[model samples]
Every structure is written in C-alpha cells, then in structure tokens.
Target: MPEPIRTFRHFRDVPDSAWRWGNFSPAEIACRGTGQLKLHPEALDKLQALRDRLGKPLIVRSAYRSPEHNRAVGGAKASKHMDGTAFDIAMANHDPAAFEATARAVGFLGFGYYPRSGFMHIDLGPARTWGERFPVRAVPFALEVPAARETLAESRTMKGAGAAGVATVGAAGVEVAQGVLAEAQGAVLPLIPYLDSLRWIFIALALAGIAVAIWARVDDWRRGMQ
Candidate 1:
C-alpha cells in the first residue's frame, strides 16, 4: 500500500501522540503560508534521527508547502516541499559540513547549499548536490559545553580568592595559638620561636594567595569581555 499523506488543517489539531517521531512536532513540519500540513513518515523519521545524532535543535527554515504556498514562494513546480520530503535547515545552530554529513547518514540524499542565505536543503530523493558550498570556516562551530562545566570554568576566579580567605584564617589561627602557648609554661618556651615562625609563614602564604586571587579575577573579567 502507498504511504498515506497525513493531513492537518492546523498543526494544533494533531494529537501529541499522533506524532510518532520524537523531538519534532507537527507544527515544525507544517506548511508555512497556510495552516495545512502533509508529510511522509519516512521523511519525519529520518529528520528525527538526524536531530538525535546531532543532539541539538535544528533551525528549520522551510518544510512542507501547500501548492498555493509553493507557487507564492516561487518554489520549483515539482519542489520536494510539496511532497513533504525536503527541508530547508538554517546553519545558525549547525556547522554546514557537519550537518550535511549527518543528514546523509540519516538517509537524506539531495543537497542544496545556500551559503548567502545561511541554510541548506536536504531531501530523501535522488542523490544530488547543488549550489555553492559555504567557504571553509576558520573555526568550526564551538561545541556546547554542559551548563555545569561552564559554570565551573566561569567560577575559576573564585578559587584563588577562596584560597586567600583560607590563608588569612590560618594566619589568624596561628597567632591565637602562639599567644596561648606563650602563657603555658617555661618548658614550652622552646616552642615559642617556632610558633612565631609559623605565624610569619602563614602571613606570607596569605599574601601570595591574595595576589593570585587578584590576578585570576582580572583574567576572568578579560575572558568575559572576549
């Protein structure tokens, strides 16, 4: 049996579970100009797989198109959008080369590069590629670091400051201990000089930590600017 076209007057009419594919809603693949929608299951399945492999959101520029909508947008007479097989995905959240590779791996065969528009078209049709490829980027898209990791790196400036606080507390603790030992006994007098020395060591460490904390804070600020 031929695969049936899933039609919706509006995406809102689609029951949530009716969309078997996860990570995508009927609205996302609906016709842009009209509320109407029609799509093939294979296309949505492949698209969901692509999204899963990428582990990120896809910025879909265009997907399904009604015949009227297709003509208004000056789409090809036989554009894949009408058949619900083509997708125009923006590269804002994706690296073009990587996106194409992943799209192909998920069974998309057609490629239409629109460098100036910053979007690419992919379809489950005859294997072919068209349009000018994007200029090789000096830097690929930055990997998304987990929020926890980013927060830890962003808080790096605090480490030195925290060390300084600890050292200051240590120095104060040494002085208090030195004073108590001074009043203990004559036999403990020999330990007095060492206690004083310990106090001085703590003070030196405290100063060093403070200096490091200052430098780290400055560096963190610079990074934020960049």
Candidate 2:
C-alpha cells in the first residue's frame, strides 16, 4: 500500500509572504536574485526553535537553490538545497560551536564548515559532517602580494639612484627611497610573524585561484575521500 503524504497544517493557512521563522523573513530565505522558495516546514520549525534558543539575529547566506543553481555552484548531486531542506548562515555575529550545537539540538544533522568562506552549512539531511574550523577569515594575500612587490621594487630603484651620488638627484632619491621602504615595511610587517601559520592556507588559495581546473578535480577527489 502507498503511504499517505503528510501535509503540514500550519503552512496551509499561511501565505508564502507570511511564511517566516524567528528572526528570518521569507524574502531573506529565498534564493539570491530570485523570488523562488521552497522551505520545508520541519526545517523551518527546527530553525525557528534554534533561533529562539540563541536569541540573536541569524543571517541566511544561502537557501533553496534550484538544481541548476546547485550544479553551477558545485553543490553535491544530492544536496538538500534542491529540496529546500538546507541553508548556509553567515558567521559574523555568532559563535560557530554554539550555533552548531543549537542547530543540532533543534534537529539539524548535516553540517559543513567553510572557514575559508566565513560561513557554515546546516541541513536537515542524514547525520554527517564535513569541513574544518575557520579560525580566521581568509586574507586577501594575492592582492597584497603584488602591491608589496611593486613597492619593494620602487624602493630598490630609488636606493640605486641615490647610491649613484648625482648631487641634488642623489640626495632627493635617497630621501624618497627611505620613505618608500618605511611605508612598504609597515604594510608587510604584520604578515611576517604569522607567515608560518598561514603558509598552507596561502598556498592552497593561490593554487586554487591559479589553476581552477586542477583545483576542481582535486576538490572533487578530496570530497570523494571524505
């Protein structure tokens, strides 16, 4: 015998525009740049419970992706986004561990931590977890590297000109070089102390940006292993 489809009685009386969880509006939980939404009643109920427990505003970073959108964003084949049972929340004002615990207590089982992206993924899917802690936000090191190198090069050129001892030009060049070097050092000085700790993260981000195709393949392989 076929099982009867269970219907949520509360959702029947509520309009889509009025559908909301605590601290989250229907518009906020909809897909980015689209009005489409398909939030599961149970998921919303659980999330509302979580919000009540936390007593803070929750920002929905992503929710209810279409299958095409999911694939475009490299979501898993069976991702909960397609069914509207998943959402990603911003971590700006919430403690990750506490948030995860609250979500778990409220019935979310799927978890994914994207420290590099400064967000966490939660879903009402089968019990499982993935990803690592994001202790700090990913630095814009790629952008900074070129600027630092350019400054260093300019300082070197100024120093070389000053060393040539060309009277007025030499004295002026020396002064300019000292100022440039000082400024450049000031910009890069803070990064030096944490170089060892951030080395792997920097390398990984660099490789991912430089070789997208390779990174995609490697990422797929890595996810498969997990």
Candidate 3:
C-alpha cells in the first residue's frame, strides 16, 4: 500500500464561504485531508500576526492539500501546500494585490496575488519569495536576446535611427572579438622584451665559432711550415 498522506485542520475548519464564497463542493473539502486544517506552528503564528496586523478576518482558501487532492485541484507538480506549510488567503476587504504586497513585506514566502480569484497565496518556508499571477504571458524573444547581450559587450554600435528603426545584436559576437584581441596581444607582448636578448646571444655564438675556426686554421699552417 502507498504511504499515508499528510494534512492540517485549521484550514479545514474554515467555513465554505472562506474558500470559495459558498461555491465550494464536497470534492474540494475532501481534496486536502480530513482534519481541522493545521499548519506548521511557526506558520500559524505568522498567519495570526498577519491577521492581527491587517485587522481583518483572514480567509484561508487552502491550508494543506493531500497528494490526491492536490492532483485533483490542478496544483503545481511540487506544491508546498501538500506539505502543510503553504496556504492561499484572502481578506474581508479582498484587495489581492495589496494583500500580496503586504504579505511579502512581512517576510512570507511564495506570495502569489490572484486578482481574478480575489485571493493571495502565501507560504512559510524560505523568506525568499515571489509574486505575480500564474500562467504569465510569454515575453517577446527579440526583446530578450539584446537585453541579455547589452551587459556583456565591451562596447557596441547601435544601428538604426529615430523611433522608426530598430536593429538586433548579441553578446557572443562582441565577446569573440574581444577574446581574439586579448589572445593576439598576449602572444606578442612577451616577444617584444626578449628580441634584443636573442639578437645578442646569436651574434656572440657566431663570433665564438669564427674565432675557433681561425685558430684551427693557423695551427694547421704552422705545422705545415715546420
């Protein structure tokens, strides 16, 4: 048999209106677990503080979801909610964006503001966090490449003019050119200082060989005379 799933009660005990404004179904209720929705003790304390500071009845849309429940609800492949350390929340005033900003400032992890759903999701693991709605629209690729390249280039020419013309470029080209220049300079730098030394060494060796040959020739001539 599979390992038993985990759950919480504080989130489960919440009234139906809190989750979906009276639209919650039995399936949604049974989705996470069968208990008064509970959370990690530290998470509960911070949540209570958030409620107190916000001065409103904080609605917990989801405290914890069982693996089966998480799968049914179209949760992310790796959801913190399944571990009883994450929750989706909303307040009586229902300002999702505002709530999300405030929650993030309070050091909550994984704050997602859902304007359409009228709630903000919060997590309590790492103080590091993120915000924004899910399924964000993809950015244009053209804008991405040049933006990335600008920081890497030593210097670059901007082609095109006025508001009507635009040109594209990348960092790889500039980086390659810079690297070639660097290598060429490196190869030539060491040779410049050693040129005089090499010339002197060659001339001295030539003189030494010439002197040895002349001495041998003189000795041979004397022997011949005797």
The number of clashing residue pairs in model 2 is 0
TM-score leader: 1
Regions more than 4 Å wrong, model 3:
1-33, 36-38, 125-226
* TM-score of candidate 3 to 2 decimals: 0.41
Residue-pair clashes per prediction, in order, are 0, 0, 11
In order, the Cα lDDT scores of the candidates are 0.86, 0.67, 0.53
Summarize candidate 2's per-residue lDDT along 3-67 as a digit string, tens digits.
Answer: 22222223233375556464677666665544566657777777788889988778889877766
Model 3 — which ten-residue stretch has the worst lDDT? 159-168
**What C-alpha RMSD separates each model from the true structure?**
5.1, 21.1, 26.7
lDDT (tens digit, per residue) of candidate 3 on 104-205: 666587766665676667886565445446443253212223333332233222111111121112223334444455567676555544544544554555
Off by over 4 Å in 2: 1-22, 136-226
Best by lDDT: 1
Estimate, for each residue in 39-119, the C-alpha lDDT of model 1 and write its tens digit.
Answer: 688898899999999999988899999999999999999999999999999998888888989999999999999999999
Scored by lDDT, model 1 comes in at 0.86
